[model samples]
Target: MPFRAQPLRLVPVLAALLCTAPAAAQMDHAPARCTAPAGLPAPMASWRNPLALKAGADRKAAARAILTPGRTVTLALLPTPKVAYPVRPAKPGDSVSHGGLASFTVKEAGTWRVALGSGAWVDVISDGQAATSIAHGHGPDCTGIRKMVDYDLKPGRYTLQIAANGEDSLTLLVTRLP
Candidate 1:
């Protein structure tokens, strides 16, 4: 009689291979938006995001968090932003106030580093409060340097409002030290 194949023996091998897959390769998740506001744009055409910095956890942490560093956050601003802060005197192609909004969630509470490419301005809003870094002359990356902002944040949801100085594209990156 010819040798018969043992189909049952292969089940264990297949199971072992499936279980050993990396966590990242097992699932595909979407990266949180970094250029657009969280839910809806607050249903306001001229709403400027608020900026605030606090020492510890607060009421804002109650909301769910949603951003992951695995994906890249890149976006283009509208021809004319609904809200513009006009940080300086308006120049041609410079609205100052026109900016895009992005929302993210903080999985762990810690000091987070937020870096913006092309010297874009950012307004951090939490619990309806806002705060910004004050610079009299120009942004950290205004002169072709990357701008970085650091803040102590609690685990919660956050809205990042950003506007390009003059360019049409902006890149926002967020990370925390291991």
Candidate 2:
């Protein structure tokens, strides 16, 4: 028999399942429990996304944290062969296809908020984890989102590039701090 049987029968089952101690009635509740993702590193243990961003259809997913320097023997590598879909396999430090995502090597791993100059959608790829599940800023007069990353950085060179449609109208300014 199909599970989509009587709708009335299902009501009671759902009600019972949802009927946990009402928080108002309970008076006291502990804390909510959660599992962190495997890839996140230390610097980002406290990572949180203010805006809910979804991993792009072609991009990978990230935990709240990321990789760290010195502590990292290996890293989450991204295979950025083509900007198109059905991405081909890649290695660590692959460049973004559309030049939309900027490739940077952070020292540690954690959730980092990206600051964009304008309200446009900016792609960010860190240490090869899927580009962070964030769309570019889209508020009034928002150019692009830009900010520092959570990965503890080492003394190394990184790349920041924007996607181009063979035409250029905007520019991205990138700087690193000590």
| lDDT scores of the candidates, listed in order | 0.47, 0.33
lDDT of 1 by residue, 57-88 (tens): 12232122223432334545544344333232
* Least well predicted 10-residue stretch by lDDT in candidate 2: 68-77
lDDT of 2 by residue, 1-178 (tens): 5567687788988887678647555656533233533333233222322222222223232232222222211112222343332222232223442223333455434444443333233344444433534233221222122223222334443333233222222222222222
Given candidate 1, what's the lDDT at residue 173?
55
Q: How many residue pairs clash in each candidate?
A: 14, 37
